[model samples]
Target chain A: MFITSIGYYIPDGRITNSDITEILVEDNKEHFSKEDIEFLTYSCTRKFEFLGIETRSCCSEENGDHFASMAEKAARKAIDQAGIPPEEIDCLIFSGVTNPFREPSFAIMLAHRLGIKTGDFFDINDTCNGFMKSIDVAGLYLKSEKYRHILVATCESPYDLKNTLKLDIHIENTDQIDNRLSGLIVGTGAAAMILSSDGGKGRITHYGEQRTSNDWDASMLTLPGTAVPGAKYGDTITGFWSDGRLISSSLIREMPEFILRKLSEWGLDAQSIDLFIHHQLGNNVTFALMDKLNADHQKAPVNTFKQFGNMATVNIPVNLAIADEQGLIKKGDSILLLSSSCGLSYALLHIVW
Target chain B: MTFDEFKLMVSDGLGIDDTLLNRDLSFRDDLGIDSLSVINFLVKIEHKFKFKFDVEHIWAMKNLGEIYDTFTEALNNK
Candidate 1:
């Protein structure tokens, strides 16, 4: 299957380092010491600089923006760009970490909002790998010839007060500071892609072998699904933890080998791929991957994390949309989407656009 | 590579003075070599030794000495 259209929506509330620090201090005043607050604020600045994330976008709660609404906006843009009747989309997949509820998949809700009459609808959660995995699933359905068109969409709002402020910020050690701050690195954004079986410019040629290591537990958001007995209403989805250093470093160490092996198997080299669209983990991870592959720096869009922060699954699609708008992609250009998720899942998908 | 040789590579790879290096120095705390840099240095070691170190072990090795011991053990096994 080939991608017919792509679109994204980044919320308007531009959040800066100072804003994050203010929230951290204001929310945890009675819980942390003066020194702890000072140290964490300093650490936030340092980490943001090291991660190369300058600013992030946050949705306004007053505007009633939630995951479903954001996904609808992004999906509508994708459908509009597809230039096809909404009825043509035979499948809708909502792939994102942040969801409005545990039941009634966002896809079911989105289909109604988008005016899609008949289609298969569901949700997939693979953390940052959600979108890529959704596309992978869509390709399988399209290959079966049962589905003519599919829309895969994602909307992540990690910066919501309920999600961010609820983090267990009672830091007992400096190491915990780094781990907790990773959750705060994410901003709010939505992205969508429309894939079709018919002729299109972008085609998924191969989905590489996914390498899953035990390191996924190194970073996680405790969602409601893992709720325990006697849990309070919001006990789940309260804690967001991550070893940002371990995750980024491990990806740097592991991705080169995994990708190179896949490239050799696919009978291609790194230099031949026109664009290497990486999951916008950070500048460190993206640039490090490029350096290890010994590929041209210009072949990859390296500044999305710095410009947009980490939108989790939304990073790649938003980057793809930006690249398209910037005239970076051309017909028949080989593209590789390198995705690494919190589950320690790694995948490299080859596409010709 | 000997501990001295590893120190030299660490100094060269991370752009620090060789004299400042020590076996007991915490890679993150003492040398200020962030986790990303430590892994990058380990990647260089992997290239030098022609073998792959366990990715998970990279985070568990807290000190320069621990990293050296693990590398030595892995290289000897290889």
Candidate 2:
């Protein structure tokens, strides 16, 4: 399937290190010691620096830029760029971690708002890997000749400190502070891409074989579910909890061979790929992957996390859009989109641009 | 790099004392180096040695000795 157009929207709210520090200090000041508070202040800034995340985009709740609204704005831009009427979209796939609704699928609501009354609409929640799965599924739909134009969009806003902070919870030690930092550094972003069977500048030629290990508990936004043993139907837990060490170590251990295997299986090499648009998990994971692949800094765009934090499922698409806009990508150039997420799943999609 | 040199390098990189840098000391448990730091440390080792350590073998390391052994395997093979 060919990518006809790409667009992204970052909210007006910009969060810096100080902003995150303020949130942590204000919420947990009473429970923390002066040393602990100092650590919180220093740790937040240091972690941001280490992860290479400078500023994160946060959605203004007042402006009402919820996931659905952001999805609509991004989708409209993609649709407009595609130069196709909204009704012409054969399917809409919304993938991300922060869909505002669980009852009605996010894609259905977004499709309605965009005046797309017809075509298939649904949501995919594979955490950060949602968008890749969406594109893969879209490719399937387009390849079957049943769909001509498919719009895939993602809006992620996983940095809501207020909602994530349980009022009763108190920071007891530096470890507690460390674990919660992941949620604070997360940024909000939305992106949309229109893929068509007919014509476009980029074509996803192959979806690399997916390799998955059940490290499902590694990273999670805990909510009331069957997985949470005592979590009643209405119960909820705030914040995105992740074992940063586990995820990074697991990914590094798994990704290199998986990527190498895929390249060998596909009869390609590191030199054949123009740009390795990777999941913006963090600076560490991205650089490690590039290092493992023996790819140069020019071959991969490594600063997306620095600019936008981890936009979750929107990470890869936003990177693609930014790269395209910045003229980093050229027509007929081969691109490899590498992604890994909560399922500890690994996938590579080859696109000829 | 020699083991003494490696110990000095890690001590400097992690800001820990050289006396604390023993082969059996767990970087995570004893040295207090978290997960992320371990990756950075491994990257530094790769750059310093100019050898790509096997990913699977390295993750199994719990102490400095295993790491040293994994990276220095080229010498053993040679």
Among the numbered candidates, top lDDT falls to 1
lDDT of 1 by residue, A144-168 (tens): 9989999999998876634544544
Judged by DockQ cut-offs, the docking class of candidate 2 is incorrect
lDDT tens digits by residue: candidate 2, A135-183? 9999989989999999999998765533643422235566665446557
Q: Of the candidates shown, which would achieve the greatest TM-score relative to the real structure?
A: 2
Q: What value of lDDT does candidate 2 attain over all alpha carbons?
A: 0.76
A14 Cα displacement, candidate 2 (Å): 0.7
Residue ranges of candidate 2 with Cα displaced over 4 Å: A61-64, A160-171, A209-213, A224-227, A230-238, B1-35, B38-78
lDDT of 2 by residue, B27-51 (tens): 7546546557665556555545555
Among all windows of ten consecutive residues in candidate 2 chain A, which has the lowest summed lDDT?
Answer: A225-234
* Clash pairs for candidate 2: A332-A353
lDDT of 1 at A206: 85
TM-score of each: 0.79, 0.80
